[model samples]
Target: MAEPTLHIGRKISKVRELKGMKQETLASELGISQQAVSKIEQSADVDGEALEKIAKILGLSSEAIKNFSEEAVFNIIGNTYHDNSASLNYQCSFNPIDKIVDLYNEKVALLERLLQAEKEKNELIKSK
Candidate 1:
């Protein structure tokens, strides 16, 4: 059998897809062509620095992308679900795009609240 680490490109491709990011989008972020991204995805290895940049764009750590694989996923699920006392209660109802949008909105709202508080503090000082 081939070494598990030999499939890093495929792992990157899978995680990119899961993030709802097209190879073209990734290519744009990486300053490479879509064809180049496709080629990298088909290869067994990618450059270390480039991989780190790609992982950041995908909102994942480089190690997460490197270690992600079907076998690993299966192992995690198997271990988590097999314990008789454990319960799997959550469901995935929305697409990844919706999830991302929701996260973005949450961050924006938090930032707006912080900005308002800062403005209030400034006004209080100015009134003194």
Candidate 2:
């Protein structure tokens, strides 16, 4: 039987994917090239500092990344959704609609910041 190896890079890649982040985005955040990010994903092990930085960028702790298991996640989802008990009550901490509104507001704020940056860039070009 082949021994199972602890692939930290794969865990980081999976977490980044789950968080809806692209290699380019993660690369930019980490101040590394996209190719470097790709290499990291293919690697079996990453150093402690790099792993910590990647974990932070993925919005997770290093321990979370180290302990990540796809099977556990699927099992949790299956249990949560497959439960048919009438007394099984699941209450969300926040309203879904409110979360949607918050996302929209954040998007609008990002657009505004982008517009401001573009305007400043144009002003600089005009002055040159």
Candidate 3:
């Protein structure tokens, strides 16, 4: 069986491939080594900055990476619940839709921050 983390790595790699980007090209754009890019695409643990850079390099909004990670975690939890049904009881007291709404709100907040930062940077450059 494949590890859940590996599944997420594969998903990231798939997205990069869909964008028609090579790992070497992305690494160069991000100022990181190709090996580092490979590690991230493979779902190895990475820092927040690397995640942000990878998203940017892949022509994705940071929110997309955030949402992808959250969805991957949700899938792992769901799969574990089903697989461990014999050993544990899973109760759903909250609606999954509510969680989705919350996540969407979080994504919105992140995008707003990014937008604000860009605006500030632009203003600074104009003032100079």
Best by lDDT: 2
* TM-score per candidate: 0.54, 0.60, 0.43
Per-residue error (Å), model 1, residue 128: 68
- Candidate 2 lDDT tens digits, 2-103: 212478778888888888999999999999999999999888888899999998988889999989988988998888876555444866769999999999
* Residue pairs whose backbone atoms clash in candidate 3: none
| TM-score of model 3 vs. true structure | 0.43
lDDT of 3 by residue, 1-128 (tens): 56664464565676677678888988899887989778877764546776677777777865575456546756877877766545557666799999999999999999999999999999999999
What is the Å distance of residue 91 in model 2 from its true position? Answer: 23
How far off is residue 86 in model 1, in Å? 18
Task: After superposing candidate 1 on the true structure, give the runs of residues whose Cα lies further than 4 Å from its correct spot.
Answer: 1-5, 74-128
lDDT of each: 0.86, 0.88, 0.74
Ranking by TM-score: 2, 1, 3
Model 2 alpha-carbon drift over 4 Å, by segment:
1-5, 83-128
Pairs clashing within candidate 2:
none
Candidate 3, position 14, lDDT: 66
